[model samples]
Target: MAWNEPGNQGKDPWGNRGGKDQGPPDLDEVFRKFSSRFGGGGGNFNKMGVLLVLIGAIIVWGLSGLYKIEEAERGVVLRFGEFHEIVGPGLKWKPTFIDEVYPVNIQRVNRLNASGLMLTQDENVVTVQMEVQYRIEDPHKYLFRVTNPDQSLSEALDSALRYVIGHTTMDNILTVGRDKVRRDTWEELEGIIEPYDMGLRVVDVAFKEARPPEEVKPAFDDAIAAQEDEERFVQEATAYSRQVEPQARGRAERMLREANAYRERVVLEAEGEVARFTQLLPQYEAAPEVTRERLYLETMEQVFSNTSKVMVDNKDGGSMFYLPLDKIIQGGGSAPMVEQAPANRQTSTSSSGARTTSSDNSTGRSSVRQGRN
Candidate 1:
């Protein structure tokens, strides 16, 4: 709505718009709104005044270019889209809007976790979870020295992870020295990140858990359990053998050795008895009468010790003597030999001590019948 419109006219003392009906403003109001606002005429002079005012305002804004950097951060100054300088944490300034300041945290560290299931050198896949801690070393280099700085971390981490896992067996990744693997991964990751000028230094890497993936977890667990059981069984069997076999062998050997020693002792005793008997045989031979008398008395005593039997001789002249042999034939004793005696008994009397025997048929035995003899 232009003010010059007739409907927009203000009322004066006669009820009309003041400025529009009055046609423009006083010259002093124009001068006051013009030169005071830095414009002279509609010519080049007015344009110069406007441009000068803009330039002066820009100068004032440029002088106020100051910022405070925290203790953990540094300022990267850019002059004309190029690296101007790197400023430490403090009150610092740049050349107004001409120089851009990028504040980068240098003291504080950042952490990231790289975790996944990956294949190992043994053609087995395992789940690996871990954390990585890093800090920015050179802030200026961190911003400009590397392209896609933030994304570079994952690539370097992947490189390190792959390198570490690729060289490790599945078992080692799942157990044993997983901590050392994480440390090695951090060092390798730092090396890769550093070369790219990502301004990241590795503080540490920790493995949360590394194990067989879910698909093969059961199989691995079963295998481990089976191995332990097998080892236990082997140990038990070995211990049983170690405990039982030696004692059994020792017992058997002891019994055999004892039997052998007893055999040797009995043989030595028999040999000694035989030698003594042989040595006494000559003495008995030289004194035949006395040895015979003593033998007779000893035999008589031994024979009568268990029985009251007595030998009787029947004095029938020509008749075959009927011997009373039944009395000596009773009880537990060696059967005494009897003979049908006639001429042999008369000639062999002294040698047999008045007893004789002969080889005969049943007729000789009838003479010594149970009741008849």
Candidate 2:
């Protein structure tokens, strides 16, 4: 049967001993009873609750301010909307509502790329692509000094690149002068950023690509190919010259040395001849006739020593005798021995009708001697 039936009109499903309708128990009385059980008044309990709430809030605010910065990052702190100290990599804390922290990856390399069509110094148009690598050197300046450092850097890079490209030739942008263009752009970028103090350090600048526009690429390619061929030919010629020059120089040095040796030999021979003539002059002056005869005999003997034939004449009988000196020389005899003949035989040797006579023979024979040719 239902509890709110006619006989139990004031009674309900909840267990209440009275017939009057009742709501839930009062919260203030419930808290007051709980505090009485804890041996504290309601006012003291309220104060303790407030203290616990305050401590909990303080702990939460402190934990909320804690941050960890990685080894590659730096933290820039701002206090009351003003620049504060820069923090290195570590766990750090800041005031919750009064300070703000910005973590920047200072160690990480960041890259910005710029590419566009630019007019060159020679009034030619070309496409250039470049990349700038940089790092944050000072995080404080990076965060506060510029409104947008990355965008500023990109604009700076573009300006520098265009400036360099405008001052250079299209061929240089596209070919052998690429390194120069890259270096100039880098330097220009540094100069542009230095005055602003952007707190960015440019690690490197790479000129990634440069090319003529599509409408003129083929002609430019042909020109570049021709230039490459010319450079190759020049390098090959240089190498060949380097290789051959030493040999030519060596030949010239050898010829010079041989000429010097020949000159020295001729000079020494002339000096020797002069010395011999000087020694002979005194003897010739002491006894002119005897010396002249001796000299004549010596000269004749010297002349006949080179002949190949010998002729002997027997003066007593007017008979001529010929010795086959050429045959004798061919028979392995280089020299023939000449002796005084008998009294009846007179011997003479003539070299091409030249004669030398010897009269002091032991057998009273006159002898003329010659030599083989």
Candidate 3:
């Protein structure tokens, strides 16, 4: 028969001997039964369970301390909110609760931009843009030295840029002096951040743009164009001077040499004539008459050599004649003879020989007869 048939005394499946309310089982009895199944007394059961929990907690804590760092990163370790030590790349471990590790990318290059409208030395407002590229050098200083290193670097860039721009001119900033501005800003930025020890290194500073305000852009553009044209013109003029100067100097040198040569030739010829005349003077002083006669004959011979006409005289007082030999030869004809009247002819007898003179109408000169002995 079933237990609930109401024919026997009060009893239940959980071993409740008597109860007004047949509720769930008792907590203390359930614990005692579970301890007995585990083969431990109640006190030993509690202690063993606590030991297992503590061991698992320790394993988890030790496992949590193991961390990995990338090749480009450096690990910064902190102990109880104080900087401890820096760790390099690869697998690393640190105490979980006593130390903290922050991975910082030391090899990564970071960039910041700075731009603003600033007043120039010439009191002109110009907008300038600059870019700074940097990388972390010391991870410890980077994390601990400053609260916000990046923001500090940005502010430093701005300060440096403003200082440089203020000392420069508008024309230079907008045109040829942009590189100078970039370099100066970089130097100034380094100086500003040096004291702060921001743990930032400037890799490069690029001058992106520098221009006048929009309202004056066109005028500045025109001014910049004029400056470029002026530079080009100056360069071209310098090249031209370089090219033409040598030729001009060469021409001047050549003319000077030619003039010197001409002067020397003239002087040498004059000296030769003087020497000849000096030697002739002595012979003329030795015998005046003979020298005079010889000189007169030489002069006549030299004069007649250049003419084509000839004159002849007959010692028997016959008719005198002139022969035009040049015209006869050129015309391929016989010589043409011309007779002269005795009244028109002139004759003189020298001590050395008989002399006869004939007139040549073509050259209007008198010729002395040569064959008379």
Give the top-scoring candidate (lDDT): 2
How many collisions between residues are there in candidate 1?
8
lDDT of each: 0.69, 0.81, 0.80
All predictions: root-mean-square deviation over Cα? 16.4, 9.0, 10.2
Candidate 3 per-residue lDDT over residues 76-122, each given as its tens digit: 89999998888989999898989999999988989999998999999
Model 1 CA lDDT for position 198: 70
The estimated TM-scores of all candidates read 0.47, 0.71, 0.64
Encode model 1's per-residue lDDT on 1-373: one tens digit a residue. Answer: 5555556655544334654445544687766677655534556666786899999988887677878888888888899888888888788767776888999988777877788878888888888877777788878778977776667786778779988988888866765568778878987887787657677777778788787878778988887687679879999999999999999999999999999999999999999989977986887899988877777766665665553333333333233433334543443333333332333122112112223333247554422212122
- In candidate 1, position 103 carries an lDDT of 94
lDDT tens digits, residue span 123-209, model 2: 999999999999999998888788999999999999999999999998777778999999999999999999889899999999999
Compared with the true structure, the alpha-carbon lDDT of candidate 3 equals 0.80
Weakest ten-residue segment in model 3 by summed lDDT:
346-355
Cα error, residue 27 of model 1, in Å, equals 18
Q: In model 3, where do residues sit more than 4 Å from their true spots? A: 1-39, 260-373
Provide the lDDT at 215 for model 1.
79
